[model samples]
Target: MLNIDGASKRGSTAGCGGLLRNSSGIGSGASLVTWISVMPTLQSSGESLIYGLTFAYDRGFKRIVLHVDSNVVVHTLQSDRDHSVVGWRFIQEIRRLLVMNWEVQICHSYRESNACVDALANLGCDHEPGMRVYEQYPTSLSSLLLADVMGITTPKVTSL
Candidate 1:
């Protein structure tokens, strides 16, 4: 399963982070960031999705379940009807990846359900531009990772 999240300090920095667990659940992941000082929030997420898909395919994984937190990204991917040129580009690339000989399931994951990726995305901004893969996760992620395996959840608060 690939659980991912993208984040941007709108116009300053942007990054994507996710964990890809093997069939038996062993894990590896990447925190790829762009130093671009003026990227949109949506585009960063879209780019993150692209990176995630390519990483999975490169590792020769044949079955994948992609869980993402952005509803716009998820809806656009599933429907392939995005109107913006940038969005169209991202969607097109992702579509090409999906049509490969693998079985991939894409779903929308709520922010609370994706706390690890959220933290990773934030931490990702600290990385120099480019993708960094981990055989072992960063020590900072220990608690979140443990919480994931234990199914411990954090509360979500919304301002009215």
Candidate 2:
């Protein structure tokens, strides 16, 4: 599944971050790509969210499970509401983009559980013109190391 989130510098954080998890296999073969964007502030709007989603889609992600802390974005995208503002043009674009064999689900997640993305976001906020990417095995020890660097506790290692 592909999970996406954003961070902003002005809001006690740096920028926006996104994580894409490839869970198409079992055990150690899983791959993940994490993306971080450094922006001036968090823009919880359709345009920014669409920008992130489109980036993932353009990169060949088919099935996506999006996680965001923005109620404005979640509600706007999930609800059947009328869009009359020009800014919401992106919302319309997002709706159109949904029909392209890509299943999109947006939900809310607590900030604490979203630490990796949070760190990426903060990194973006702290470093101007910031961007970072990690391609790794989500179930491997190195994945745990990457998670640790993000301040997330590594899961208990279990042997098969």
Candidate 3:
């Protein structure tokens, strides 16, 4: 499974999300596979997990390697912590899904390593005209988005 970590920065605010694909090379130029965007914050409960499980079950993913940037979410999914909170319930649902035939594991990657995913995530929060496509992307975009999120002027990438 290919895992992507993504973040979006809006003016003085930021949001993050992840994309997981069955193909090992969605962004690496290896294989093409349908992908799913995973957002625990968006779910805030078992709703998203249940939806994901049903979709994965129908799609027949042999093994599921869960990729998550949120350490809290990852830990909760790994243990039987009886967190009855609505948010924790979703984590439990994910755990239950893990117990199925699908082999479940988690991997962590620096946000930079998952730029494509991060861009997609950013779009989810504050989509702008320039962010619609990956091709011809500008590096300055990172600074711009960060500046917007931080409510600061976009920094000059170089003094020149």
Q: What is the lDDT of residue 7 in candidate 3?
A: 43
Residue 3 lDDT in candidate 2: 44
* Model 1: per-residue Cα lDDT over 26-64, one tens digit each: 332332211111233446687777788888888888999
Tens digit of per-residue lDDT, candidate 2, span 1-160: 4445555545644466566665542123345566556645435235335656777788888877877766666677787995457546667887887777788877876655555555555555665555566565223235533553455653444599
RMSD (Å) per prediction:
4.3, 7.4, 9.3
Candidate 1 Cα errors over 4 Å, as ranges: 26-42
lDDT-wise, the better of 1 and 3 is 1
**Across residues 97-159, which tens digit of lDDT does each residue of candidate 3 receive?**
767776656665444444544554555455432213233223534553344335454233447
Off by over 4 Å in 3: 2-18, 22-24, 27-30, 34-55, 83-86, 126-160
Q: What's model 2's lDDT at 9? A: 43
- Deviation from native of the Cα of residue 131 in model 1, angstroms: 0.6
Worst 10 residues of 1 by lDDT: 31-40
What's the distance in Å from true for residue 62, model 1? 0.5
Cα TM-score per model: 0.84, 0.65, 0.53
If ranked by lDDT, best first, what sequence of candidates would result?
Answer: 1, 2, 3
